[model samples]
Target: MEDVVLIYHNELGLAFRWKNTVPNADYERIQVVFRNMSFYLLQEEISKFSQNIRSAQFYNCSDCKANKSCRNILLKTPLEKMDISLNMQELSKLSDLVEGTLFKLDLQDYIWGAGRN
Candidate 1:
């Protein structure tokens, strides 16, 4: 039905919490400069919903390209919050990805893509 993928700054070296509420679900893991379970993945177990990724979060993202390429494919994506404290520009990149949600927390100066930071 639904699932979560949490990637910390460690570059996915750890598989912390991954499970399937569905009866017959799949999963997999892979390695690459940058990867997405749908296409760039070298291998994965959730082949069924590989294209149906739901919510994903980054704890301390050191580097991420997924935020630019396919960050908003799933119109019904459960993803709402992503901790982009380092790469503020990435959140700006999502300006068109999500208009109203670009910056709503800090708006004092709102210089950095709506946020004052």
Candidate 2:
């Protein structure tokens, strides 16, 4: 928590993403470690950021090659709509809430998941 607070206050320019370490480059589904703490803190940070962010897109694309855009400042845009379907999978069941917000499937399985304004 302290680390997140420090980063949020001192280094607001950085957005932290937590993922498990991939091992054995030759293996397909290698066991990876999860950073649960950072994930939790990121959830909180997203909630806070959502309170004010009107136009933004977030995504994860592991299959991407090495030369992908790393930050929002480097992205091409018309200053209105943002496309983030690169690392996202097509979901089958996501007709419950607002559109344009599903990453893989509607995570509605989690109690009162992220819907609503």
- Which candidate gets the maximum TM-score versus the true structure? 2
Worst 10 residues of 1 by lDDT: 96-105
Give me the displacement of residue 33 in model 1, in angstroms: 13
TM-score of each: 0.18, 0.20
lDDT of 2 by residue, 5-99 (tens): 11121111222222334233222111111211112222333333233232233434456665444332222222234322221211111111112
Report the Cα lDDT for residue 77, model 1: 23
Clashes of each: 7, 0
Off by over 4 Å in 2: 1-18, 22-41, 54-117
On residues 1-117, what C-alpha lDDT tens digit does candidate 1 reach at each position? 136343212232222123555344343332111122222132232222222222222233445556643334322222233222213333333222222211221231254564444
Q: Global lDDT for candidate 1?
A: 0.28
The 0-to-1 C-alpha lDDT of every candidate, in the order given, reads 0.28, 0.25
